[model samples]
Target chain A: MFLIDPILNVCERLGRRLLMLFSIVGRLVMFAFHALRDVLVPPYYPKLIGQQFINIGYYSLTVVGLTALFSGMVLALQSYTGFARFNAESAIANVVVLSITRELAPVLAGLMVAGRIGASIAAEIGTMRVTEQIDAMTTLSVNPFQYLIAPRVLAGTLMLPVLVFIADIIGVFGGFIVGVYVLDFNPYTYIQQTWDFVQAMDVISGLVKAAVFGFIVTLMGCYCGYNSGRGAQGVGAATTNAVVSASILILIFNYILTQVFFS
Target chain B: MKNFKIEMQGVKKSFGSKDVLRNVNLDVKKGESLVIIGGSGTGKSVTIKTILGLIKPDAGKILVDGQDVTNLGGNDRDEYLKKFGMLFQGGALFDSMTIWENVAFGLTQGQKMSKKEAYPIAIEKLEAVGLKESIAQHYPAELSGGMQKRVSLARAIARNPEIIFFDEPTTGLDPIMADVINDLIRKCVSELGATAVSITHDMASVRKIADSVAMIYEGEIIWHGPIEKLDNSGNEYVDQFINGRAEGPVKF
Candidate 1:
């Protein structure tokens, strides 16, 4: 009985922590649903939407493009070295393009954008809330959620897929450059093999993932910003929470969607 | 002339175990400027926020133009909000926007006016606040502190709202700039015939802008009367606050 006491205490503590984590996630899910419900019924702001499109889409292109390019190049080099040892060097092109276009392009682009754009959105809105700009907007008969959150979320959903599409093309081209030029593979054969193995489902699946990742990123950012407490410390805490939550949710959703699509 | 513009009754707000506002009651007549003076953390800002429905009171009634606004939500709250304007303590201008755009934000975004329609009104408001047309193109970051406050003031009056709130309007300004701002606040409120409610500890601003004054202590209105009667109000808290003495009921 004495030996069991310590074990039981540890179990109880772990159970309590898990329950708290679940409650927090549940509250966030409920908040996201409420935001979506509000979004569907709108006195929409086209100008604000356009502004956020530039913010979430155009501004994020550089980081996502750079990440995809390097990732694809490295992937090709590693695959070529491994396949050559097995006298399967011709399979390098197929591996690189299929892996990049199907998975890395969307996931890497999503995560990079989540880190860059998600933190900015949270900090910007959190500062506004702390400084009373949101209240001022309310006093001027403007709905802060409609003006701020809706536009960012809409832009995120629309823009990420476009970004992922661009990343997919760029990443494949990167792989091609590495394979044909550096690895001394025949350009014609590499292109043919890549085209043969890459299917429409792969591209479509990547786009779907991009869209879901966008939703998670924007929702997490807006939620943290809107609920930020008071002062500089509160805003700083919100920014950190936004990035961590978005990154985790992106990975979790990626796993679930992959299972549903492939399993 | 005697109509009540804003009124509060038995407003009580508590944050956790600490009571910030304790049964505060007050009134402001039309076309009058009321300045609320209190020490830091005595709920001066909370009182105003409650009236604007930014913070819901734990127990109270707030009335603007005879309509109870304490529990209004959605479209009703939005409609109620249209009649008010506020100048935040930090100016709170969008950093990405130019001075003219900041001033015209409500006109263009909230009222659905085109840029062409809004820009001219924004320039006009800027001129009224003594800013040149050239300054209109500059971002808030480019402006000096005094200029930023003036731009904020212009933005607050852009919609010609009937009720205006200024929260610590002159807290971090140089004495000369603070005086200039106080004069501008007075001119704007009177010229627009707006009912103004300001919360501040700046005695110079209070004397320059307020027609009436209320002193909040421990979340309650310890003293309230016309500005002319403030010196002789006989309330120890009011006397201590206005005189800037540390040896009174309000401890540092």
Candidate 2:
């Protein structure tokens, strides 16, 4: 009877935790619905969307570009070491181009954006929530879901693909520079090989992943921030949760997208 | 049967297991300024928030002008909200926007007025709040707390709202600044002829801004009457609160 009582207590605790998790997910899904719905309604803010585009896309160019370039360079160097042993050194360009266009560009760029933009969105909105700016907005006849969340979510979704496409180009260029200057490969041959092996579908699939990751990043940020609890500690927790959740969702979606495209 | 601008009947709200408002019933006459006074966590803010429909009551009816607005949504909610302006305790000015832009936010965004049309009005409201037109270019973060609070007040009064809510308007201000704010609030409410609902623990603010006073204690209105009756209110809670006595019916 004592053993049974302990087991029942453990089951009750687990069940309560599970219920809490489901409730959080449900609330997040509802928040996303309202955010997306507000996007299609009247009183759209094109200016706000454009401002977010500059913030999420243009400003993020440096970090994402730098990360992609170095990653491509490293991939080429690593490929050479392994392929040279099998006399397959000629395949380094193919591997770098394929990996960058199909996977690395979108995934790495998404994580970087999740770190930068997600944290900022969460902190900004969380501060607004605590200070009652959100309530003030409500009293002033402004729909916060429309005025705040819609523009950010739309900008994130649209701008990420553009960034990833640029990342793809810059990454391939990085591989080209390494192949021609350091690896002693013929520049023209390397270019020709990359051009031939890369398919349109590869870039398209990567861009799709970028869009999904962007949506997840901004959505999680808005959710965490909008539902943030009362004080400084709440805002801090929201920022952390936004980054962590966005990064995890990015990785998970990247795998699902890869499977859909390749498998 | 009285002429009421706003009324909360049996209003109740709870966060998790703790009930913030167990059964709050109160009303304000048209064009009257009512100040709610209470100790912190006694549900003064929650009471007004429930009235404004910002915090939904768990079980109650909130009526504005005798219309039950408890379940209003979509365009109905937006139209209902257009009648109100609120001054938050922390100013809540948008840090990203300039002072004029912050003042003009509801005008531009809610009323669909163009920025150019709203600009002069924003400056005018700022001036009305005793701010110079040159201060319009600066952001909220650059302003002193008092100046920011003034800007918030300007924004609140900019649209000529029919109702205004001030949450802890005098909090965190020095006596002089708080006195200045209290005076401005009185002037603004009188000039606009709007119904005003304010929540504060500051006795000075209450004396200055309130036509009537309601004292909330433990989620209930323990005492309510004319400002002249405040000192003589027989309720012990009101006596202790107004006197700032540590030992009383209200323990900390």
Candidate 3:
């Protein structure tokens, strides 16, 4: 019995951590369910929803656009360098547009938002949690989920697609500029190559991925913050956890979604 | 007693292994100011929170106005919650909102009153709490702690709730400010003819505001009597607690 004690201790610790992880996931699912349920109910706060749309969707446009433009320019240059060895330099614009629209723009935009909006949401809600404001709202007969989580989650989901749409356009334009101005390619040929290779499905799949990423980012923020432990330390932990978890989920889901749509 | 406005029977709650409230029982008569007094962390706050439907008891029945509220939910819970108001320990006013907006929250959010309709009522409540109308535009952070408490009180009594719960309404205040808050609490409760339940470790708060007193110790209601009978409670726990004794049945 004594000989097995160390092994037992290790197993017990591992088992406990696994149980805790499962419990956290369970709580997150329940929270998402309740938030979605509130979305379908009456007594909706349209004013709050509109404000969240602006905060989550409209404000995110700039970052998405900047990331997409730089990513497309880099993609054209790098693909030109790689393809030049094989005498396939003409395919650079095709590769740039495809990569930017199908992968880079959505993933980069999601990561950027996960860093920016996710941290802000978590900090704000975490402070509310610590200060007993959330409790006070409950006491005042307001559903905290309805007032807080639903609007943010719904706004994130609805706004990310629009941001990605604009990003896609900016990204292709960037590819055109880099190919013609920097790579010594014909502008008309670059545009034609981009238009020929990129299909409507490529754009639709990226938008779908962005929407899911948006949901993941906002949900993680709300969950971590809403369940924040206590005081400043807890809120700080929550903000960090929101950004980290959202970024991880976006990366993980990006691969999974790509496999689904492409494979 | 059918006349009891709020009653807790065998209320029990625990966080993990530690029991916060253990077999706690109490009752408040209609329109009475009942002050629950105890040492710090003696479950006084949890008791009132359970009554307010914030913390559901692990085991027991809680009745409000002769109706069991232990399992209230959905619209029923919302309707039940409307009968009461609470002033939190730290004066938990919404930091994101202005003083008037905080006061008008339940009015606009719960009662469905338009902001235009609720504006005058918010100012009126602020005035009733002795706050000037100029401060209505200021957020909670801009105010002094005493001013914040007063604003919280104003928000609490805005809708004239029939039952009001004060959680440490005077904890961080000086004697004068504490007494001022106690007076506001008493005045507001009386004006609405509302039943009041306050939990505080502050004896000064009890002396100033209580019609009845309950002392909780080690997760139990060790003593409960009228304020007049408190000096001669004839119980060791109450005796030690009120007299500020370090050595008695109350073990540190």
For candidate 3, the lDDT comes to 0.90
Please, what is the whole-model Cα lDDT of each candidate in the order they appear?
A: 0.89, 0.93, 0.90
Q: Compared with the true structure, what per-residue lDDT tens digits does model 3 show for residues A1-263?
A: 98799999999999999999999889888999998898878678999999999998888888888898988888888888899999999889878878888898899999999998999999999999888888888777788888888899998888888889899999988888888899899888888888899899999999999999989999999999998988899999999999999999999999999999999
Highest lDDT scorer: 2
Question: TM-score of candidate 1's chain B against its reference?
Answer: 0.97
Task: Mark the regions of model 2 whose C-alpha exceeds 4 Å error after superposition.
Answer: none
| Model 3, residue pairs in steric clash | none
> What is the descending TM-score order?
3, 2, 1
Candidate 3's docking class is medium
Q: What is the lDDT of residue A224 in candidate 3?
A: 90
Give residue A161's error in model 3 in angstroms.
0.9
DockQ of each: 0.61, 0.83, 0.77
TM-score-best of 1 and 2: 2
iRMSD (Å), candidate 3: 1.0
Kindly indicate the candidate among 2 and 3 with the higher DockQ. Answer: 2
Per-residue lDDT of model 1, residues B51-116, tens digit only: 989999999899898889999998898877778889989998888789998999888877878999
